[model samples]
Target: MTTLASVVSCLSDYDPNALPVAQAQAIMRDFVQPVSGVARVPVRSALDRVLAEDVLSSIDVPSHDNSAMDGFAFASAELASAAGEVSLRVIGTAYAGVAFDGAPTAGEAVRVMTGAVMPAGCDTVIPQEFTQGDANTVRFARDAVRAGDNRRLRGEDLARGSAALSAGRTLRPADIGLLASLGIAEVSVRRKLRVAFFSTGDELRSIGEPLDAGCVYDSNRYTLHAMLSRLGVELLDMGVVRDDPAALETAFRTAAENADAIITSGGVSVGEADFTKQMMAKLGDVTFWKIAMRPGRPMAFGRITSDGPNSQGAFLFGLPGNPVAVMVTFYHFVRGALLRMMGATDAGAPLVPAVSATPIRKRPGRTEYQRAIAALNDRGQLEVRLTGQQGSGVLRSMSEANCFVVLAHEQGHVNAGDTVQVLLFDGLV
Candidate 1:
């Protein structure tokens, strides 16, 4: 129910003319709320889904103290009095699913396979490679292993009754395996968020349509579809709405009716032909901001009310039109907000520090996200170099770069070898 007026009234020094990047982010954080819908899904099907509740371990992870390696297990006391080497008689062999029932005397050892429960009274394991002889008897160097080594203690990975995963966590492959280890066949997770998006431009045409002299194919919709698909949201692509007030209004209303959030590329900037701005004002209390950021300075954000039978309202994000600007704005702004809507509790993507290979011209008032290639230098340290083209319209720049070199709002010019923050495009997904 938060309107632009209410958000602005709360700020002491609010400036609609040129808002800071942090201020815009703060507005979004204060306005958006996570969805409350929940569902029970199989653990394997919960990958990338936000956990609805904390997962507690029903039993110990290993369920018993086991050998961490294929080795001979014996009491640590047996090696205490050893001078040059420790020798012990092998009592019996224990496989992964089996255990040695008989207790081992001080001079006796038990052959234990990896994941096999430790033999009774055994507290250490010497890998077969470190010991000489067969299951009958084994001898190892006195300093081969420390006392109480190579034995995985029961409940060490996850103790029974302890929280295995916290609420709001996005389940990954490792998390799924951990849940399986704890005998969790199903988990409660938040439902996937539905996002409706479209492009606003009269000169844009779909791929199958014939290209006019002044019109180009609408690449923004395809890119948006790809990007949004990667985020695991249910996407409702409303296609390209021509630059007409009536058409734009219909598209906006339809998006608001069907989606939790709506994204549109183009028509937010100061342009004579931009009917999107006028129509957006009539439909909702959205605010158009010229943010202190490079490439994507103009953006529109707010909630739009829908009057359809099943419709209530939806969050709106009007991004810039340039091919690269759409992606830059999405990653920097829309991505985090969408994640919040999906009920994910991740703070944000981590910034990596790297040495700049070339000097960068920058001002102190605007944040810049320059596409760059980050790689290891001769010293095996991460170093970044700018992509060939820095133009916002050059979609190739995004394709050529592995990361975005982020220059903060207050940052000045950067010299070569200067350390800078880089947000990687790959990994950590």
Candidate 2:
């Protein structure tokens, strides 16, 4: 039988195109099915949450024909005889919450404010700025106000029964306002995917803890937590787990039982102390162990199965220990998987093409993601410059980068000013 280490070693020898980034994403999405269910959440708690079903407008957005400006509401024919200026009787006044209730006569208009329903017979509104107004009379300027000017018709913003938002749309502030306008107090949103994450290895310590000779502060868990939080996931922080098998097993069991997915950094590689892979085999089936990529080559994915009466299956992702590698794999692998599980029909990191600001060297075997600081050049074109170093453990470089300049497996040695594809971190770093 091929050992896991040998399997990973063989992956580097395969053609990178054989398992292209797109194809790898498709495979992972296809393999790990979404947890099947929905939950109704209050609108107040729905921000940044994905909808499980389409949200239809319960009522017309404006609900009724109303005024868009605080001005005079009048019949269109009243201004016909006025060559340079027109004057009309202001029959009554209308505020935002109150309407004139009576229609305007041929030469009579109503004083209307913004958001007030237009009177029955009024078809136009001249702004108060464009009109001379007294206690009960208003005068218009030389310009003819168009019919329906300043009037917001009912259902203009959204028609009743129309889809206000499609399923799988991550709600934004504007979306929330739209929902409120339609009087939807609650929404059917997919339950936030519960992700339990942690970092492993005896050499890792939490921040503010005393650092020993060989130990480094745990940064992956916090980074992953922040990224997952931005995605609106329910994070179950398992803190830092040690390299021992018993501790690993306990963490795995707890995560599998409670979370929809579990993510861990380090110990998935070929080291002898890497007990994560071993624990996974004993508890869950390893779906695919490795991929052809730099800094994140030892990433793994699988499903944890259970046998209890209410046993639920959960997806698992193991990332490399290095801070930069953890970030790369999360964006490339974990984010895509989470999106798919949340019912996203289309989900992947956006790769934008940009010009290289300087030369970058690489071999043609492993696909490399170089941390780059991007800025628009003098011509208003996006240009990317590499950070100081490209090492996997360089957290400082990753912190300084706004995007990754993606160099393909077959592409070797790029000179300055070459066009390259860049994957922007998109404010998630």
- Tell me the TM-score of each prediction against the true structure: 0.97, 0.83
What TM-score does candidate 2 get on C-alpha atoms? 0.83
Q: Which ten residues in a row have the lowest lDDT in candidate 1?
A: 1-10
Q: List the residue pairs that clash in candidate 2.
A: none
lDDT of 1 by residue, 1-429 (tens): 556788778999788778888898988877888976999999879888899999999998778999999999999998788988998998899899977779988799999899999988999999999989864889999899988999999999989999999998988899999998888899999999999999988899999999999999999999999999888899998888998888988898898888899999999888647689988888887898999998898999998876888777889999999999999889888988998998888887789999999999999998999999999999999999999778999999999899999999999999999999999998522
Which lDDT tens digits does candidate 2 get at residues 1-429?
223233334354433233556456655766666667788988988898888999888788788788888888888776676778889988899888877777778779898889998888887889888888688899877575876788888999888899999998878899898888777899998877889898998899998999999988898998998889888888899989988899998888888888899999998776647588888878886644456677787767777755544447678888888899999889888888898888765455678989998889988856889999888999999999999889999999988999999989788999998999998987444
Those runs of model 1 whose alpha carbons end farther than 4 Å from true positions after fitting are none
Between which residue pairs do clashes occur in model 1? none
C-alpha lDDT values of all predictions: 0.90, 0.81
Q: After TM-score superposition, what is the CA distance of residue 229 in candidate 2 from its true location, in Å?
A: 2.6
